[model samples]
Target: MSRGLLFRLVAIVVVSLVFPLAFTAYGLYSGARVERLALEERERQMQRVLGEVSAGLREINSGGKNGDALDREVRGVLNRTLAGYPGIRGGVFLPETQRTVIGGELKWYDYRPEVWPKEGRELFRERDPVIREALDTGEAVTRRIVMYRGEGLVHALPVTVGGEKAVAWAEEVLQPAIGQDRVLRKWAFLLTTMGFLVALASALYISGSLGRGVNRIKNGLEQLKRDLSYRLPPMPGELGQIVAAINQLAQGLMEKERLEEQLQRSARLAALGHLTAGVAHEMRNPLGIIRGTAQIMAQEYNHVPGLAEDVAVILEQADRQNRVIRELLDFARPAPPLMQEINLNAILESVLSFSRKFLEQNQVNLVTQLSPDLPQVQADGEKIKQVFLNLLLNAVEAMPTGGTITIETLATPDGVAVSFGDTGPGISPEARSHLFDPFYTTKSDGTGLGLAICHQIVTMHGGNIEVETGDRGSVFRVSLPRSPERRDAGGTLDPGD
Candidate 1:
């Protein structure tokens, strides 16, 4: 697995576990802290309550002072408080003596003073330091104790009557501090869960990054398999090194391909050369014999019936064979092209004339829109003539049905333009792509070097030829750069084979 991917997955797992767990722990700890604070507050409030009761009592019952209605109201407040606070451990409230006991022996039990203890405030079990301090001050006592039931806090306050005498005390018990602890537990769990998830997400993200890089490499490889011509994208990091290596491998394969092509071409050319040499050698003797015999028959049968015509046919056949050999030789060892400043218009017109007979034979129409004033282009006139003738002838041949061949020209500051458009079937895409490739031809008896040679000659002239074809037929655009010194808008010239 890639490092990024590994990091992401591990991060996911870790977050899944750590967030919930740590949140729970933190929640628990916080809950405990809140619980303690709540307990402390409860104790302080208890102390305040006690002080209020005791002070109220002392105002009325100080120095053993008492009142009947005050006793009734005090009893009512105690009853209500005890009822509201179920956790409270009840204690005496006096309006006569200023004494508040948080935890102590009751002055009376079962309707009578029982188990009364001296200094009852000190006698109670002290559970918290604040409560002890409150008692010593004779103000109030707030403390926690497990005297009668479950753990609880005590709040007590002193009361005085008149101006200077202690009167009574009020005491109340509060619930324990543990309830708030539960909330903390929940919070801690939440925080831990969030933290864990964050970590896990990070890991997952890293892993995905790694996986993405690998996927790119895989896709690049697949595309290479489909099209060897396609180049792969540059990979990142060490993977870049891998891509570089793959590129090297592809280059090696391309070299091998070139070598194979060269080998195949060489092999075919060798076979063709051998066959042509042998055939030409073999036919030469027969051709010479036939020529000599034809001459003798022409002379001897001059006054004979129609033997002269027969002799002529024989001679023509022999000569045609010899011409075919000459064509082969021309293909094998072509003459070097001689370059000159030739007018394209004349060349195009000459080809048109040559194919004019064919065009007439096929009942095809010929049209010319040659530029009025064209520049003389530097080229091998003979080869340019051949290119023009071949193309015109092909166009004429294509439209066995009567059609028009249109030739046009355009002159520009940059170059000379000649356009040949034929109202025949347009060039097929598959064949057009390789039209200039040697041996790639649509016609059955075609040597297939015509367009290739045209391309070579045009290129030699420092020009380019382009073709566009569709349902509207085919058009060839030939562009030749204008000569440096000699410039003519467009003009005419005589061209020949």
Candidate 2:
């Protein structure tokens, strides 16, 4: 199964979103685990400190100390033990007297010494349950709590001092860890936001590019519907390949349509040729008799002014009709070209020489760009000359007022091409469609067989003729293969009219 553009884009978006989310979740989870481990280790350290303090109290009480001396000894032990641990405070709680003795530098009371007793009482009250639990169970207890400064850990150990049950406790402020955790959270949030933004940007860019490519294809298809010659421009990646394929398909369809039209035209011309052959043959005998009778009358009535002129008119019309009959017969059954290898340039030069007087008389300026390296082609030299001559005459006729006729010859991959460019009013689309049809002419006196004969001659020679017209003028190009053998061996000519 193939996935469409939508499916691929959706998958990309999903993956982009998921990867960052997964990474963020993992980072948070890992940070939390590390925090938990650090807290656990701190709790263990606090428990060890309480145990040492409790042992010191027992040793002091065993020395027969009591009252203020006993309290002093206990304070000395706590201060000595807790001095090594910064942010830690240790104390002993007497359940019977409801007394609390705190140790260490007591820096927590730097600002307000009078509130020490009150703050101590409140601290004791908060830990009263853990202290009682330790005294009753005779086991150590640990708890995590949030104090005025920040989060911290507390541990309590029960011991017998002077035959009285007492609780020894120590706490370490976890302000540093708390600060670190807050910073970690901020960084995580920042990274996650950045990742999400990057993902969003990437998705948007990809989607936009895809949309443009799709729209180009869509618009190109719409244009193709309206005009078969329309083609999509080149693109990049997969879309470029698609555009190339579409253009190729459009070209093929255009070619196919042209071939169909050509086939229809060929069929129509074949039928017309048969009919014209029969008609011309039937008219030939009567036409000959009329011309001969008119010639005799012209001679005999030479002395008669009006009769001689009338006979001359008859003779002229008869000759014109005879010429028409000959052209019709030629179109009806064209003779096969006497093929031979010939230089196209030489033929062009010959025709130009023959038509120089005619071109000059018509005020036509001829410009020739014949290629010296133009290859010879296998064709009838006389017929090829005729084709060139006919094209030159047509150009001269198109530009009645003085204009330029540019003739160029260039070598092709398989053969040679000759183009005749004329400055004229340009052929209209309506006339261009049937420009080579038999008996189709734009001029009042034209039999329309000139271009029709040209088409038949070029086609029989395994070549093609094409015309390009615009406001500038018209360019008629004729291309012939290097040899008939090459043309027969799958060599194809470009399509034209």
Candidate 3:
């Protein structure tokens, strides 16, 4: 089945069983929780009300508390309570006599003095155990068959009524005619219906999504196996994240494939360089022999030596070829660096200062535009210095007659930025691309390892280096991230917009 249909099926089954069962169960449990909390709150409220009542009644009955003023307050309690729970059926207030002092018009009610339950003969009592416990503990006592037509809760409290300490008791009973329980049940049903619909919708969404996700992953993997180049296109919501992960995985695979291809190409290049080196070595011996033999022949046949100049030229050209081969071998492999944190600014200043005299003699003005708050980037300063020096040397060499060399420090969002511009001849578009290649150079006498080593240095420092050739001259830009910031950097150099 399709995931959307299966989800709907599961939801239908769950909804069929859960709603009626939970609703009925809730009806049984809700009343108990409410009753417990409400009953406790009611008991606390009653205790507070009765304390003042006891004190006032005592004063009124004995002329001891508040000088008869308490009598009015005692009457107020009777009047207020009748208004509060009018269905209270009625109660009696007694100060001295054990007889009930019924409230206004209370005698006409079925609730009478005869209805108050009392202990029988043979009971060892100053008062009934239930009343005594309630009075002594200052707590309510619940007893069976003690009051009118339901569960009755009684509280007995001590008072100084009629200048003698007496006990006052009060009772309340829960009646079934209020219809509150029915209203409560109706709300409970309505709440259950709403909750059921919400949960059903959520579950439907989740189940369908889960099934769809699993299918997408399965299909994606099948496609990936057949075509490793396949990419996971973006989707909506969390499935978008799944697609992102798939894309990331696909990208990683692609990078690995690219690395493998590079390695294969490197192997091919290594073989070719080795073969060329061997051929050069073999030719070196023969060329040396031929040059030596030709020189000897020219010396001996000087009388008929029209061919001496050509042989000498051949010898010189062979010497030049030998030198080029030697350079190529040297550049084929480079040594690992002694890496350490060193200031590039210091290195640049030192190298430029050292080369300053030679540059000035040739009318080449060396400009220093170091950053005021240039951060100390971690790098092998010696290697980086060699790179800057080589570029400078190359620029001077390129600008044979004379020109201006502008060196500047820059701060970039990506990292620390450095730029070098020379008023040398502009590089051709073709030669600029291969400028950093091992044996690539525009100058005939140049070794060509200079820019290549410079590239290696900047890359090792986790920075990038690039060159821009324009109408003026060539510019090399370097970017590097400043080291992790410290707690409170003292006046940081912000890369202001």
Candidate 4:
């Protein structure tokens, strides 16, 4: 979810950044387009100016004046019209004889090298095709004129002065429009860069804040898992509501656990009563044999052969009764634990070492993932070791053939957790509830006090033991409270305090 949030934030930021850049690009395009239209309109105005100059020449020609007078009138029209336009570089009136009739400069070449009066024939034949076409067809034609020094729009119109074919042409410069476009591009680039950086910084800040909020919620959830009594602190908005809901869930779980414990206690008492009656009945037969054997031995000592055989039977039955009594007593009342700071990993290793040969003989593979940095737990070393040993033995027994037993450890907010998993047929739901009951056993020879003792030991150490079973196998998890220095910030196992 956090990843999705980050991606969306980044997507929004990218879109935010792209918009300004795209807008700037559009502005540049629109500006260039407008500039182009304006330049074209200016060229049209220049063409119109040339038209007026051409019309004046035609009017003067209509008078039928001969030689110098008509030439002077056309020359006056060209110079007077050219003076009115700032963009007009120069102009020339080329007569059919390749002579410059009206050159804007005093000397024809003084105006410009590529100006029509200095190189009119070459301009028509090579550079300006539309000009040549206009001269041949006796019509007005326009073309773009580019020289080494500059470029412009050119218009050429065919005319007859005193019955001689002539060409009149004008040029308009475009350097100003090109320079404006360069300036506009630079501004657009600068604006885009600054906008993108601002958007990136803002996105990073917003996304980072969101990530931290999600991490806080995650940490709160872990706290709830590690300590059932823990409640989330107040948070703003929907997050606050989530915290309240989780607290309610914890309360519900606590209530369920309390009720389950009461039910388990009732069930254990009923089972214990039944087991006690059976044990009592079993002990009576052994006790009767011992009593009868003692009386017979006293009456027939040294008088009966093989009387030792009878004595051996009596001793064996006595030992058997003693073992049953001892098991019953241990289950009925367990001794207080001798607490010490012990590493759970070391205890697990010790249990594994003891069971390594047994596992190998039974073809059971063992896997351990003990944390090297696990903190020492304030627990009874022998008792915790016994707990692990019992669980390991049970896992090995669960697998009749070759299988795996995996032991792993992880640090929790309130403590450390160790898990024992067996790849064997899982416990049925009916049997699962009675797995930890004293005197209950799935095995024919088992006294059924092993896991029951383990549960008791872990409970005494201020920890818990839980079991999960499925089709694949079963897992037993033991959560032992950490030492004072390693406990959660809000909790400590300081008996002195």
The most accurate candidate by lDDT is 2
Worst 10 residues of 1 by lDDT: 488-497
Q: Which candidate is the best by TM-score?
A: 2
Candidate 4 residue pairs in backbone clash: none
Give me candidate 2's TM-score against the actual structure: 0.63
Clashes of each: 50, 0, 1, 0
lDDT of 3: 0.61
The sequence of per-residue lDDT tens digits that candidate 4 reaches over residues 1-497 is 66777788878978877877887888778877887787678678767777777677666643556555555676778878777775574354554435455444322543223454645445434334665687888887776666434555677778665556777777665676575675978687787878788877777787777777778878888987766767778777777788788889989997897568746654554456456646655776778777677767857795778776777777676776666666554544445567788888888888777788999999998888988889888988987888898898899889998799999998888889999999999998679767877768989878887887777677667777888888999999999888533222111111211
Write the number of the candidate with greater TM-score, choosing between 2 and 4: 2
lDDT of 1: 0.61
* Model 1 lDDT per residue over 187-286, tens place: 6566666667676676677577768778888888898886555577886788789888888898889678755754554455445555654676678788
Local accuracy of candidate 2 as per-residue lDDT tens digits, 229-257: 88899999999999999999999998998
Which 10-residue span in candidate 3 carries the lowest summed lDDT?
A: 488-497
Predicted structure 1, TM vs. truth: 0.43
Residue 338 deviation, candidate 3, in Å?
1.2
* Superposed model 4: Cα runs more than 4 Å off: 1-48, 55-74, 80-90, 93-139, 143-153, 161-165, 172-326, 336-361, 365-389, 404-421, 425-448, 458-497
**Residue 401 CA error for candidate 3 (Å)?**
2.5
